[model samples]
Target: MSDLTPDRTADPTGSAGVESKGGDRAQYGMCAGLAGLGVLLLVDAARLAPVQSSNDALGPKPVPIVLGVLLLVVALFYAIDIWRGGVGAAEEGEDVDLSAGSDFKTVGLLVVVFGVGAALIAPLGWVIAGSLLFWGCAFALGNRHHIRGLAIGVAISLITFYAFAIGLGVNLPAGILDGIL
Candidate 1:
């Protein structure tokens, strides 16, 4: 059989050494998860029996359909990558660490932060909850600028709150700030 090993010093696809499989698994996993989520969304959309609710402009179909289509596109790309033997340019013999200690820590912190933020957002209101999310993320990501980070986080939270809550007129739970917002 012809050697499957790509030359180490040479570009694999003849492109300018543009890609690596370093995070291909992660990307694939994300895509798979998204595709699964899309399937769920599509199912839910199908099950959506129209009912009279306070909010009745756009039915449940729109968001779910949009999400499903987008997710399907992402899934297609990921599957293509897998079919192409991943995005790795390294030779067949070359080895790399797909999982690292820092990666675990980062992923763990992200899960915790998202879980806590989602749980707290309703009870704490957007501003406070968002501030917590922002500051917590900066800390988790090993940001060094303590005050600056916090400031930036708070600013982001406020801006996001204003844009989504105020500008878009989307109804987000006020939680603690129910009367405050």
Candidate 2:
């Protein structure tokens, strides 16, 4: 629409364009891919050695096997629906901003924030690094309440870190808090 804006007339999935073959194929392909993943999971689970002292008749393989069958069934149903001219419903989430063009600056900032968080995680720990990541993203997204944003970020990150570490037994890097937390 502007002199500086690249002519997006050829961008098949751009705001200027309509229903694209690439997008349609990708949607169906992803459904097939999900089904493939489920099959792979089930196959791999089947290859696992059975528990010697198993009291439960239904072992680990049953869950993955059931998941695989469900995925396959869903994929088939979705394919049939698509073939019958059925279209997926649009997302009604608050994040929808169809009118706005791509905000490259915000995207770039977020990328940098995430990259920095990854680098810092091993040294600073999940709590600290994740907090910074959250705070950086809030600022990048135009949230001006710096203190409130950082506070929320720190709280959420710390909560998630402990949840994964203590509740789920996942070992997130503790770094400086290694001995303490």
Candidate 3:
């Protein structure tokens, strides 16, 4: 039999042995968090000013309302599943070594890179700061081709900057390249 198959012999009642033990109580916290977030979203959506125009009739309220309702539904189903002792199955194909230690050096480097990138955003602009962030992350992850990585990073940053600032009509600080861009 496959590892995924439950052992019926362990429980004559035909339910998972966990049901008798009262299931996992820890998962209830996730359900409660989801429900709370759903309520918050609903409340926020309710507070939005009604917008009626010829171009757009629906406004921004529908999306948040739908999302909030979906979250609540998902939370209810998750709580029910948890009450029935339906725990998630363990991954069969995972190759992680549980005994191995975490690579803190890489993590620390990435964190520092992110912090520097955030600090430089207003001064250097999205293009320069984002390029540095991308290249720094690549270097942290062991990319050896510095010039290629930098070029790719610049391209990505420019694309995102144009996409968000011009295409999507979101304002991004132009910083040093304020007039040129």
Candidate 4:
């Protein structure tokens, strides 16, 4: 029998039948990255001021601390799994054509749109600039309905503007609509 063929007599499940030459070492990089991110989060979270109020109890430390610990635990488990000769399964049910080249035209258009949005932000403001950005992105991605795209973009931008300004207390530039906004 060929080395590539699984030994059906060894195990019915076929998992332990075909021995991998060596477990994938690439997964260890992900484990390291997760651990690094966890450490960074813990450090950053530690730097936050422990300010407590009647309305906001527990401050801003618990969430990051919990997330950091969770990440560390996950990283540890992932590393252990990798050590046990675990390999990721191949993706299934996708109809992607791997041979097709990237569509640079759409990418270039999106870059231009993003640049234009950034340039317009200071002069036209977040609402208008964001609307243009959203619409332009949709157009670049092949959305043909100009009026509908524009309306949707406007609504999204307006909602985000209000959400950031009112909900988060972060002031996005009002620009031309300074007094009105």
Output the number of the TM-score-best candidate: 4
Q: Name the runs in model 2 displaced over 4 angstroms.
A: 1-34, 51-63, 80-100
Q: Is candidate 1 or candidate 2 better by lDDT?
A: 2
Superposed Cα deviation of residue 41, candidate 1 (Å): 5.7
Clashes in each model (backbone N, CA, C under 3 Å)?
0, 0, 0, 0
Q: What is the C-alpha lDDT of each candidate?
A: 0.75, 0.78, 0.88, 0.86
Please give the TM-score that candidate 3 achieves against the real structure.
Answer: 0.79
Estimate TM-scores for all models.
0.50, 0.67, 0.79, 0.79
Per-residue lDDT of model 2, residues 96-169, tens digit only: 67678899999999999989999999999988898899999999999999999999998998899889988988
Checking candidate 1 for backbone clashes, the offending pairs are none
Q: Ten consecutive residues with minimal summed lDDT in candidate 2?
A: 13-22
- Please list the residue runs of candidate 3 whose C-alpha ends up more than 4 Å from where it truly belongs after superposition: 1-16, 20-25, 51-56
Model 3 pairs in collision: none
Better of 3 and 4 by TM-score: 4
Best first by TM-score, ranked: 4, 3, 2, 1
Q: State each model's C-alpha RMSD to the native.
A: 8.1, 7.3, 5.3, 4.9
Identify the candidate with maximal lDDT.
Answer: 3
Q: How do the residues 104-181 of candidate 1 rate in per-residue lDDT, one tens digit apiece?
A: 888889889989998898888877888888888888889878888778877987788778877988876667777766
User: In candidate 4, which residue ranges exceed 4 Å CA deviation?
Assistant: 1-23, 49-59
